[model samples]
Target: MSASNQGRIGVLLVNLGTPDSPQTPDVRRYLNEFLTDARVVDMPAAIRYPLFRGLVVPLRAPKSAKIYQQLWTERGSPLLYHGLDLQKRVQEQLGNDYLVAFGMRYQNPSVESALQELRDAAVSRIIVLPLFPQYAAASTGSVQEKVMDIVSKWWIVPSISFISNFVDEPGFIETFAMLGKAEMAKHDYDHIVFSYHGIPERHVLKGSHNGYCKLGNCCNSYNKNNRYCYRAQCFETSRQLGKALGLTPEQYTTTFQSRLQSRLRDPWLQPYTDEVIKEYPAKGIHNVLAFSPAFVADCLETTIEVGEEFKELFEEAGGKHWQLVPSLNSEPMWVEAVAGMIRRN
Candidate 1:
């Protein structure tokens, strides 16, 4: 490749971040920034600020910091470590043609830094790919907004393209299906549950172009009316992966997990993780496996929440087997898949 052609395309991988350290201050800073985003909290700062600063951060930070302590390893937060690995692997696979960078939406190695890396490389074209598989305003859209904010200030902004979502991408489906099938083969599970991260119904409505997202079958249909609906995209993710794994509609179910707060009128994804675990025993389902595809790397949500908490609940509910399908953390195939996706774009 000619010197001038080097770094022609920049691929930026963005994910929800983790604290720089397990300390309370670091965790608090991370959480405060993450929760305060209008897309994430979806309330006026006048109202949400008090709740987040006075109540949520103060109360949750210490506890969450402890959780981060447990999750932190020698390489630091698993999310950051795996993100770095993914960036390296994707860069290697893409050769010298593409400049690859990774960033977290919340904490250290931020979107700003990633864009700066691309800028420093003098990339001619940039592809911003949020690590979120499904399109959620809080996650993917937030990343998009930040990327635009930075690029808009650039004196020489290159051709910029944002990947809206890749829920139905063949490589993505194959990667999830391979992992799911491998997990299933290890145990004869009676039920397979696809538990994605939850978002408030109002967030969906805010992003909806029309009044189409009712948060019900409206999502399941995957039509133009519900195209950008996060809930619908999640269902489509499950449906496509299940079909690839040869799972019958009755053999698997989709639910949302990791809801931090409750809404009276607003609906989140139905059949929360705990409820699904509790009801499985009554249905004669002794074995269950959970796939948290919402997260690209195993964080507290996947490790403690799904692995430990849900495992205990299923065991208490008379379930004999409980397993969690692992996240796609720089697996070679996944690295190739990400590179392929970028190449196609």
Candidate 2:
């Protein structure tokens, strides 16, 4: 690469994918690919493949398709479009010298194609930022693994870097805090919930640095020791947002949601969002605002699951009000935060 091209750095932003459309067949195709990833399921292929394809996808696709329909907008999947816009804005921030591209770990606008775009740009170095603020094997790890698998086959691989996590990034926390503060001012919510997507307990143990995470209160504190622990990072992000928004410990709680079905009774992070919402009413916490910090964009999980289904549950439990704090989505601060991460890397 020439000196001019050497300065032409490429930044690729990766996000968890969505179905190509809000239809059953497309949803099933997406579910099949997403669920079958070894990083995602992590079970013996003999058992995992059969169960995922035979029972799970077939049974769940239609229901999930309906949820996707609810989440669909005029531009289609919010996740994909927001991701695209983020890519554009970050590129604008970096100017013409940097090539900023976006890709999905699965489904449309794949990592492979995005890599090709960077390669075509003839950039000397590449920086990949997985859109998940907190790291997990199922999300960030999977994206890193796929990127390497593709780049390894290239005739020449340029210098490539990966940002594994950004849970405590100041700008990131500030963006979420800004959103939460706006919601707090809008409603006199009785309690606040930071609801993150749930992963199997085993997954945490597998990623634990020398078994540091006991999957207990040790995860409540964030430090170099438990830095990569997904649960710990989630709590840390919550605490930072709480501090920024001037929320008391008694007024807010962190919970997990969207756990997939498993044959074994392995526990995921708790208290479950659905269960917590139901309990809120009985605890005299009638009005609440929930945040899905795991997601940067409103999708099936954040929009349909937390915003819709959880609201229904809380209302059914006699809660007077249930509100969902929207995800960052292409917010100006979030875009700037992402650009900062790329520039810093």
Candidate 3:
């Protein structure tokens, strides 16, 4: 293709988002927007708004501010910096022909701004890649919804494409496997934990096509039946990583974490990471290595929650050691993977 033809193509990368700063007010603003998203909370505004704004935000913001403070770097939030770096590398790989831009779903460098940049370039087509490896209504789906909502109002809309998920993509799987392998090489851990973000159990059943996702070994394999099921995809991701790392079923446990409050009748994904960690010692698994494949970059969830908070939990439960494998975050392999996806699309 000629340079002109390729330059007409625009690539917009999106991630979940981060607070503008580690300050309590900034974090609260971010939380307010994020938690208020119907897809994320799955409740009516009258109820969700008051519960999150009145209760959750007020109680959690200060504590979350402290955690984000720990994660802030010289460049700012690790998630934001990593995302910016990833955008730069992808642009470099695609060269000047492709206008590769990035934005977050919630906070600064908003999706609206990024879409405006691509629209200003007068590109003929735009490809949106939500950085979440799995397809979740709250994350990848929300990005798509917002993008469409914005572009639908444009006087002259461009051809927009979206990469919803790449959980089973070879490049995606290999990149995480490589990261996990390097960590495993450094020490022999008694167990491996694959902890993904929790979603309401209702979320899974809500989208199930004729009850396909029973949430058992049904997710051990991915097919058209459970293709969009986030829980299934998470399990399949763990399965792929296990094969790459030569791990037997007994050596690893797949669980969910970071669950927000829900009604007693409603349950999120089970084998909750925190609860499971406390039980590891009694099961004779003292040391553990965790992989947060759900995240492409090390954010609060991976850094503070998994690496620090969960590590403390394991140790307090009489466990000897706990280590979290670093995320792919702007790694060369991941950059190539993303570039390849754009080219393929």
True-vs-predicted CA distance for residue 331, candidate 1, Å = 1.2
Where is model 1 more than 4 Å wrong at Cα?
1-7, 263-266
The digit string of per-residue lDDT tens for model 2 on 123-197 reads 889999999989999999999999999999999999999999988788888988888888888889899999999
The pairs that clash in candidate 2 are none
Could you tell me the lDDT of residue 169 within candidate 1?
83
Write candidate 1's Cα lDDT for 1-345 as tens digits.
763755568889999999989999999999899888988888888988888877889888999998888889999999999999999999999998788999998988989999999899899789999999999989999999999988899888899998888888887888878888898878798988899999876787777766777767777667787778888898998899889989898989998987865532466767788888898898899999889978878888998889988999999989999999889898887888889889989
Q: In each prediction, how many residue pairs overlap at the backbone (N, C-alpha, C within less than 3 A)?
A: 0, 0, 0
lDDT score for residue 326 of model 1: 89
- TM-score, per-candidate, Cα-based: 0.96, 0.97, 0.97
Count clashing pairs, candidate 3: 0
Model 3 stretches astray by more than 4 angstroms: 5-7, 262-265
Q: Which stretches of candidate 2 lie over 4 Å from their true place?
A: 1-7, 262-264
Better model by lDDT: candidate 1 vs candidate 2: 2
Q: Model 3 misses residue 20 by how many Å?
A: 0.9
lDDT of candidate 2?
0.90
Clashes of 2: 0
